[model samples]
Target: MARIKVRARAVDMLGRQQIAGIPTAVHELFKNAHDAYADNVRVDYFRADELFILRDDGIGMTLEDFEGRWLTLGTESKVGANDPGKRVWTGPRKATVRAITGEKGIGRLAIAAIGPQVLALTRSIRPEGLGSLVVSLIQWGLFEVPGLDLEAIEVPVVELQGDALPDLEVVTGLADRIRANISHLGDQIPADMRQRLLSELDMADFDPEAIYSQIDGPKLAGDNFGTHFFIRPTNPVLADDIEQSDDAGSEATPLEKMLLGFGNTMMPQSGEPPISAQFWDHREDGISRDLIGGAAFFTPAEFDSADHHIEGEFDEFGQFTGSVSVYGQPARQHTIVWPDSSGRPTECGPFRLRFAYLQGLLKDSRVPPDEWARLSGKLNKIGGLYVYRDNIRILPYGNSDFDFVGIERRRTKSAQDWFFSYRRIFGAVELTHARNSNLVEKAGREGFRANRAYREMTSMLENFFERLAIDFFRPTSQFGSEFNSMKAEINQEAKLLAKRATKTKERQGEFKTELDTFFTSIEKGHPTREAERIRAMTEERLSAVATIKSPEAAADALLNAEADARRAVAALEKSITVIKC
Candidate 1:
């Protein structure tokens, strides 16, 4: 019998290289928490220990679940939730939220991408309260053993009461003895190293008696069960030490970068619970940062605007159903910004789009002209069309780089018609699982796949923006006072461009007529092939100019064909003068 073997490095490749980044890997874990029906998920970065502790107040997995489902790759537990025919819900969470954010089972392997050592402790909630907590220590290195099949590797699992800490007694005892002995050998060690060693003492911070006394520690959280993922990073480095250099060789890890970028945004502020505390609600604050000071509301009707809205309702399984509101003043014209013959037929359904014209405009543009640089920085840091699935965000979707809906791409193609790009427009398309089941996420957790449903979703969104730009964002007499200065500036710029084009056209026309006349006179006098070819070419150039449909096309013709016509006229005049002499 032939044996097929896979190396452990493959797991690492699948986890790290396959996913976008560490931040995305963490986001996948967050999705897993969401799928697990966790109302509150806490992500803690232990700066000292070089560890990430992601705990959630959700229905945790049982021993069987840990081994059979979690350990097993490509499990179908989450896939069941994708089916609209059946509703997937956990114990008490059923009353609140029934949808799952995860489907592909490979998300669990994201832990391997982030770290090699995973100490996953979870407790399933019983009807009474806390249940038996299961601890699974996964050393990813074991999978990398030579000549070993992935299936052969077994991660050990230990079950304990909700209050029981993993290796608490032994670790605490050792920590205390080590702490006591540290003072004796302190003179031999450097002061900084000694302090570092003292700070690095593990399991000594927690009070053993206090932890043991509680029948249900923070481990069993929320209304039901909870899960804790204690991961020691493979590339462990002190957070502070990472900032010592700015070179590529000394750059921070993805997790470190994410922490530096969004830590302040996601971290709980004043009067909030600590990382160890349970069920801290950061949704409001989080939304504010996530949206970059943009509004987080459902309908534009709430704003009491007379703006127009496009509503879509689909009865098909997993179709989009929601209203897209154009926030700016609706104009009479509805222009299509699509490239010629490249526009796709788009149907609307399954999602909500809100074109927030001035949502973050005030916040971003409030600064003085001199402070425009600061404002630009802020906008770059915190602007984009956000995609919210249900209420939560999908990682890297509406980020600075992930212009998934191709707003900038469209803007580049149709700059005149595009009101604002992904950077300037504070817009969002919200979707619910019940309504948007067909919009499935890619297994690699990048973003939604470009399926027919997603393509339709994107088309509908593009149309919404198009409507806003052509119909609403356009200058109007109704809001003349508001747009008067902008209109004046635009008019002045346009007139200058038009004047330049007119001068160029007159020059080209004069030259073209002269060139054509010269060629025609030559042909009539002594018909030559060169004269016919020159006349033909000149006529072709004139035809090109006449056929110019848009301002862009006209400018292009003036720049190229008009310049060539002038040169031809100059050369023809010189030849005629020479012949006369």
Candidate 2:
């Protein structure tokens, strides 16, 4: 029988295919750290030295574990075979409580994907006053040899003895270099820490330098066991791939630097405003410039509870549980135009949506105009619909480029009615490892396969957003209808006033003609009292006609003029009021 063999070229191909980009490869390392149950993971990119370091205080692996499990592909540590062909839970707790994220045992390959060479230095205590450490060097360039079998390649591993090991001295210098590279971590590094390294540093008893003198100094002190992965990419350009702002003149806050560097979803042109303690809630105040138009927006309180917090759970087919909190002023009305199979117009999702009015505004913000735009950019990068399995974000699921629920595509189809955009939402879906095992991720770390459970979950979310759109736009639609009705009524009354003014002018015109005829008849005659009185009444009537034509003139003006004309006629009946012709 012939045995199947994997070529060295296949390993290189898998690395390229699995790790999408530099950012994705970095995210994979974060998952590995989380799986190791590390409370804090430190990632440092030393551009000056073209080095990338990821250090975590997790349970470091021994030489046996490294060769047997870590090096083996498709290791079954996370899940085990139930009988023969099927796999079941293996209780993924090594030395700590954590939901294991590294199931396929290929997370280590991500380091190779980022660079050609990698150094993994891991240390773990075995017994009282005894510990073990190993330094493994993986040079990927050797694997590139054509037609080389993967089984033939061997990574160089060196085991270190107690304090005497020379590797300890090199590690000490490397630790110092890492510390020197970073000026200050600010809130990221605890301020009260005695030693420079927050968790690893112990200056209480041993001299800070003594830790470097012996392997037991800081490296082996108090469960500080971990792996420090150092990789220096062959390409010099890869070192500076992660750009930094070069404005030496202006001091940038930690938050600003993060937004500028990682805000992938930010609009290209809307320049982020300068970070200040004052303009935190600028979104509300800015949009409120037009009060009437802005009133179209609303808060979750209008539709749900006053708390503005929403929570739900699902254990039907797969276990899903999460909560959402909404904040900010409110957003403009977004209508749902997408027609559902049920013949009803769909909105956003079957999952509850708690929209932050100003894109990603949270509750804690009050006076200081929160950088709403920056916050939006940050949310856009993280994803509006965040999906987390075992509290770890699944790749390509909630990422900016990945539209898991087809929100972007639907929005593009008809943006007017289907106005839901990933940028405008800050949402999260939490799934446990045991309950959501059915949401299996692809080997490439792209995302969960489109299985039945995954499809149902996405469909439910889509329906939720759709329903929200319908409910949200209902009141605004009614308000618009009422406004149009009132406008029509006002217009009708204005038209009636114009018609009455027109009729008054016509009567005045007829009276003017009669007066002119009377005057013409008396042109060649002598004085006549009755004729003079008629002329006087006609002049008074003409004055009323002018007032009638001037619609804006007081309504009383027409009435007063008519009364005077009648009196003049009565006077003519009695005797003469003006000289007759």
Q: Residue 550 of candidate 2: its Cα lDDT? A: 59
For each candidate, give its TM-score against the true structure: 0.58, 0.55
lDDT of each residue in 96-176, candidate 1, tens digit only: 544566766656777766665566778886455556778766655444334444654445566776465666554344445
Residue 536, model 2: Cα distance from true site in angstroms: 66
- What is the Å distance of residue 210 in model 1 from its true position? 8.9
Q: Best by lDDT, which number?
A: 1
Residues 252-346 of candidate 2 have per-residue lDDT tens digits of 22222112212111222223211101101112223312111111112222223121233455335222244433332232333332222344322
Clashing pairs for model 1 are: 320-349, 320-350, 321-350, 331-471
Q: Candidate 1, after superposition: displacement of residue 49 in Å?
A: 1.7
- Rate residue 579 of model 1 by lDDT: 24
